[model samples]
Target: MQTVRVELGERSYDIVIDTGILSGIGERIKGFNFSKVAVISNPTVFNIYGDVVINSIKNAGFETLNVIIPDGEEYKNFNQTYQILTELLKNKLDRKSCLIALGGGVIGDITGFVASIYMRGIDFIQVPTTLLSQVDSSVGGKTGVNHELGKNMIGTFYQPRLVWIDIDTLKTLPKREILCGIAEIIKYGVIWDEELFEFLMHHRESILNLDPLPLTHIIRRSCEIKAEVVSKDEREAGLRAILNYGHTIGHAIETETGYSRFLHGEAIAIGMNREAWLSEIMGFLNRKDALKIKAVIDSYGLPSELPEDLNADKLISHMKLDKKVEAGEMKFILPEKIGKVKIQKGIDIENVRKALN
Candidate 1:
């Protein structure tokens, strides 16, 4: 097992990555002092791995409660959040109680948000089942449910007490979901590590085939890169926004489609392509580099182009509403090379339109 630490001083936590670690999670987390435990997951995941986790905790001599929510990004909302809070209330969970997020990103987000707000902040652990969650959403403290107005609009930055990643859990993941996770893995390579990019290109087949070694390395390195970034800029005041390289336009696409048309990583895949084109037009990245990025994304079976029905004007409008925007101007993180990036402000709308075209 390899451990990476997100150093937030009082909020610091370790992210443990290994295979078959789920069987020992109860003893692993027993070191933390808490009165009670509640695990939040979706039915799909509960049927698969929930029993083992709950039993493990129970064996460790802790009272445990399970709260299962509906699956999917669309269901990450107030109604579900309310349901979780109601469960916590009925169980009389207090600030000392810890919430365990035991599924993919949606479960982690909702569970973390509940822990953050319930009784003015309790503790929580993250057991990310999907690759997207393992590499991106699960590690970061950013937790929230979708609002009627937007994705993750109602949220908070509540760090987890610990994060447990078992790569074996991904073997049960569907191919499309694996592709969705690959998008975020690709994002880490595009924004920070050239070696990681080369490693991905070389191991594409192994990763796609779900070979254990390659997948483990991919998850570990992705978490390392993400941990390095989050350690420096926990609140996203400056450096962390670079992690949002493909997210600006991606979030817009998600909002426009009402969060049903594409997976988070898929939308970000398209967003990276659009941003790469804009980077070329603005003289930051070369055309050849842009094509290479698109090719890598395409090789993973991810979409490299926007849908024909999506409107450029509407996308731009949605971008304006993104939380990253400041003082009426949209901010974008654009690549200068495979391992480097720059955030540009007041990007020309005409250039954005041309990229969308």
Candidate 2:
């Protein structure tokens, strides 16, 4: 077992990673003095590893209940959040009770949001089952549901008490889901770690085949990079904005497509590619390096270009409403080179148009 710590003083927590770690979670988290615990998951996930997690928690002597929400990005909204909140209330859960986010990014996001707002605030644990959640969403403590107008437009900076990652859960994911995760993993390499990028480029087959050694290495490295960044800029005040490198255009794609079209990582993958082109056009990144970024994305079987049908005008319109915008000027996190990026503000609309086209 390996652990990565997110240092936020009192809010600091450890992310525990390993295969078959799920069975030990209750024992690991039992030290907390919570009065009650609620496990939040979707039907699809609950059907898989639900019993193991619940049994582990129960064996640890904590009173717990399972709250299953509907699956899918479209269900992550006020309606589902309200449902979870209502369940917590119905069960008489107090402030000391905890919430366990027990599925992928959507489950983790909603559970954390519910914990943040439930009776003002409550503790929450992230047991992210999917690769995307395990490496990125589950570690960052950025939680919330999507709004129709924009993705992640409504959310909180609430951190989880612990991030419990069981790589074993990844075996159950579909091929598309695995690709979604690789997209985020690639983002970490592009924006922060050159060695990681090279590792990914060299070991594409091993990683894609889900070979345990390389898979665990990338997940650990991605979490480590994310943990370091989040610790420095917990509220995305500065350095943390770099984490949104692909998200500006990505979120716009998600919002414009109504969140039903591309998964978060898929949209972000496209965003990263387009933004790389924009970076080259603006003279920050050379065409060679920009194409190199695309190559890594392509090698992983993730989308590197926007769908031809997605309107450039509408994508821009949605981007205008993104949370990253400052003073009506759209801010973009553009790659200066692999392993580094910069926050470019007030970019010319024509430049964005050229990249989109």
Candidate 3:
């Protein structure tokens, strides 16, 4: 297993990535001093790996309660979290018990949110089952649900006990889902690693086909980059904001479309381009570099632009409510080049509209 450590002092944890690692999670959890485990997942994921994960926990001497929610971004709200908390209480899960998030980003977010608030806080392991979750959401301690006005507006900075990623799960994902994950992988390249950008460009065909070697490399490097960032800024105090390179507009896109029209990373794919264009408008990113970024997103078979039906004004309104907003000015994380980004504050609302146009 490949382990990436998120060093947050006592709150530090390991992100373990490997094929067939799910079956060993129980043994891993036992070491965390948690006796009971609450397995929170959606129906689809439960149907797929429920037996294996549950049995593994049971074999490792853990009393387990499985809470299955409906699968979708729309379901990631207080209602679902309330249900999970109710199940935890009904199951008599205490601080000594841990919650294991066993699905994609939604499951991990809601489960971690529930774990954070339950009896002050409880241990939770992120068992991300999708490409998008494995590469991005699972490694970060940011956990929350979307408010009607914003994405991840109702969340907390709660780290997990462990992040267990099994790359084998990618095989079951649909092509659209694969593309959604690629959007994030592309974002990492744009924000932090120029080498990763070129590496992705060179292996585009292999990555598109989910060839194991390229996929594993993407997962490992992406997690390492995120883990390093989180270690420095555990609470988004300063350096961590760069991780939101395309997220301000991306969150707005997810909210404006009601989280139905696009996947999380798909919305971010559009957001990345729009924000990069914003960089160009601000005289930060040159047009040639901006177009280079957009072209790469296009090559991934993802949407590199916002949907026409989305109203620019509505997106702006949603963005004003984003967590990144400070003093009535939304802070935009824009790319200046393939491997570097800048957080531009005091952004004019009109400029955002222009980017949408």
Candidate 4:
């Protein structure tokens, strides 16, 4: 197992990445003292690995409760969050209760948010089942549900007590979902590590084929990069914004189409292409590098363009409502090169429109 510690003073925790770690989760968590345990997950995930987690906690001798939410980005809302909180309250779960988020980004976001607000704060573990969560959402401590107004419009910086990533869970993920996970994997390389980017390019075929060796390396490196960034800027006050490389436009695409239209990573894939093109026009990224990014996205069967029905005006309206906007000025993370980026502010709407097309 590869372990990375997120140093956050009293809130610090370790992220464990390995194959088949799920089976040993109970033994791993036995050291923590808690009055009760809540396992928050979606139905699809529950059907697959819920038993393993529940059984482990049972063996650990803690009173446990399972809260299963319906799966999908559309279900990530205040209603669902409230539902989970109500369940926790009904069970008389105190501050000593621990939550285990056992699904993808949506589950992690909602559960972590609930943990943050329920009784002020509670300990939680992230058992990210998808590649997207394991590498990105599960590590960062940024948690929230989508408001009707925007993606992640309501959230908090609530760090997890621990993040256990079992690569074994991903083997059961749908192929399309696995590709969605790759979008974020690509983001890590584009914004931080050139060597990692080259590694991805060289093993693109192997990654797509779900070869465990390369997949494991890809996920671990991505988590390492994210952990390093979060350590430096846990609240996203500075350098952390670079991690949003594709998110500005990506969030707009998701909101305009409704969350159901694109998977979070799919929207990010489109966002990366659009932002790369924007960078090229701004004289930062060259056309060849931009195309290289696009080719990698296309090679994995991810979308590289906005849907036909999407227009500049609708997208612009959504962008204006983005959570990253400050003083009504828009900020974007644009590529400077294959492994470099800058968070540019006051981006002209005209240029954004041109890049989206």
Candidate 5:
């Protein structure tokens, strides 16, 4: 087992990583104040590991409430959040009772949001099953639901009490879902660690093969990078914005597709490619490096282009409403090099449209 710490002073928590760690979760939660625990997951994920999670809490002598929502990005909304909160009320759970987010990003995001708002505030634990959630969504303390107008437009910065990552859960993920996760892992390399980028390039085959050693290294390194970033800028006030390198246009794609067509990482893979192109055009990145970026993204078997029939103008319109917009301008986390990015603001909208085209 390995641990990464998100150093937020009073809110700091450990991200524990290992295989089959889920079985030991009861021991991990032993001292928390909550007697009754709520496990929030989607029907699909709940069907897979529901019994084990419930049994773990039960063995620890805590009452467990199962809250299962239909699994999908479209379900991450105010209505679903209301449903979880209603369950808490129906069971008469107090603020001391913590919420356990036990699935992928959608489950983690909304579950955390529900915990943040229910009865003012309640602690939440993140047991992210998917690679996307384990590396990105589960660590940052950024929790929210998507709005039709834009993705993650409605949200809050609330940290989880603890994050328990059991890589064993990934065995059940589909190939497509694993690709989605690889996209985010690539993002960490692109924005921060040059060595990580090189490591990914060298181990591309190992990653595709899902060998245990490389997989463990990737997760631990990604978590370490994310933990370091969030520790410095917990609220995304400045430095942390770089983490959104591909997210500006990525969220737009998810909204345009009604959160159905592409997974979050799929949209992000496309966004990162487009933004790299834009950066090259703006002279921040050279064409050689830009193409290399796209090449790596393509090698992951993820999409790097806007859909053939999707309208560029429509995408720009959606981007205008993104949460990253500041003072009427869309801000982009543009890469200047493989291991560095800049939070570029005041970009011309026409340029974004051109990149989309």
Candidate 6:
């Protein structure tokens, strides 16, 4: 097994990655003091892995309850959060009880948000079952539901006690899901590790085939990079903001499309490409490097441009609602080059308009 430690002082935890290790999760989390555990998941995921996880937790001597919520980005809202919160209350889960996020990013976000608000705060574990969640959302403590106007506008920096990633879960995912995960992995490369970017460019076939060697390497590297950033900033107060590399415009697309048209990482892939173009136009990145970014993204079969039907005006309007906005001025994490990015604030709306168009 490979491990990445998220060093958050008192709240620090380990992210465990391996193949076919799902059966051992019980012994791994047995050290926590909680007597009761709630596994929160969507129907699709629970149907596949719920019994194994719950049985493992039960064997470890905890009272376990499974709650299944609807699966989709649109279901991540006040309604589902309230429903989970009510279920926890009805089942009498208290401060000493832990919540387990047992699905993908949406499940992880909602479960973490519920744990944060439940009894003023409770321990939560992330058993992310999707590639997108395993490499990205499962590592960071950012948790929240979406609002009609914005993505992740309603969330908290609540940390998890553990992130158990089992690579076998990838086998069940669709090719598009794997591509989505690659988008975030590519984000890590572009924002922090040039070597990682080159690795992806060189080993595309092996990574796409889910070859254990390269697949494990990219996942571990992505987790390590995220762990380092989160440990330093912990709350997006400074250095952590760079992790939002493509998220500024990505979240806007999700909001404008009502979160149904594209998966989160799919939207991010498009955002990264468009933002790379913006970087070039604004003089931060050279055309050759910008094209390189686009080239890699394109090679993955991910979308690299806004749909012609999307209104540029509406997309810009949604961006204004992003959390990065300070005093109503928009900020962007623009790539200066691969392996580095800077937070650019007070950029003219006209420049953003040109990029969107």
Q: RMSD to native for every prediction?
A: 1.1, 1.3, 1.8, 1.5, 1.6, 1.5
lDDT of 3 at 172: 86
Candidate 2 runs further than 4 Å off: none
Per-residue accuracy of model 5 over 1-357 as CA lDDT, tens digit each = 999998999999999999888978988898986868999998889999989999998999899989999988879999999988889999989968999999999999999899899999899999999989988999988899987765678998999999999988999999899998899988998999878877887888988777878888999999999999999998889999999988988988887887789988999999999999889888899898788888888887899999998888888888887767888888998889989999999998878888888
**Deviation in angstroms for 272 in model 2?**
0.8
Tens-digit lDDT string for candidate 4 (1-357): 888888878888899988888978888988899889999999899999999999999898989999999998878999999999999999999989899999999999999999999999999999999988989999989999988766678999999999999998988899888988899989999999888888888998888877778988999899889989999999989999999988888988887877777888899999999999999988889999999999888888899898888987898888897778899999999988888898899888888888988
**In order, what lDDT does every prediction score?**
0.91, 0.91, 0.88, 0.90, 0.90, 0.91
Off by over 4 Å in 5: none
**lDDT, candidate 6, 2-67, per-residue tens:** 999999888999999999888788888888878689999998999999999999999998899999
TM-score of each: 0.97, 0.96, 0.94, 0.96, 0.95, 0.96
Top candidate by lDDT = 2
Tens-digit lDDT string for candidate 2 (1-357): 888999999999999989898989889988998899999999999999899999999999999999999998878899999999999999999989999999999999999999999999999999998899988999878899877765567989999999998998988899899899999999999999999999999999988788888988999999999999999999888999998889989988988887788888899999999999999999999898899999999888888998889999999998897777889999999999999999999999999999999
Model 4 steric clash pairs: none
Model 3 global lDDT (CA atoms, 0 to 1): 0.88
lDDT of residue 256 for candidate 6: 86
Q: Which is better, 1 or 2, measured by TM-score?
A: 1
What's the lDDT for residue 287 in model 3? 94
Q: Give candidate 1's error at residue 191 in angstroms.
A: 0.6
List where candidate 1 sits over 4 angstroms from the true fold.
Answer: none
RMSD of 3: 1.8
Off by over 4 Å in 4: none
Candidate 5 yields a Cα-based lDDT of: 0.90
lDDT of 2 at 298: 88
Cand. 1 Cα-lDDT: 0.91
Candidate 1 lDDT over 165-223, as tens digits, reads: 99899989998999988988888888999888888888999999888888888888988
Minimal lDDT window, size 10, model 2 = 145-154
Q: Judge candidate 1 at residue 23 and give its lDDT.
A: 77
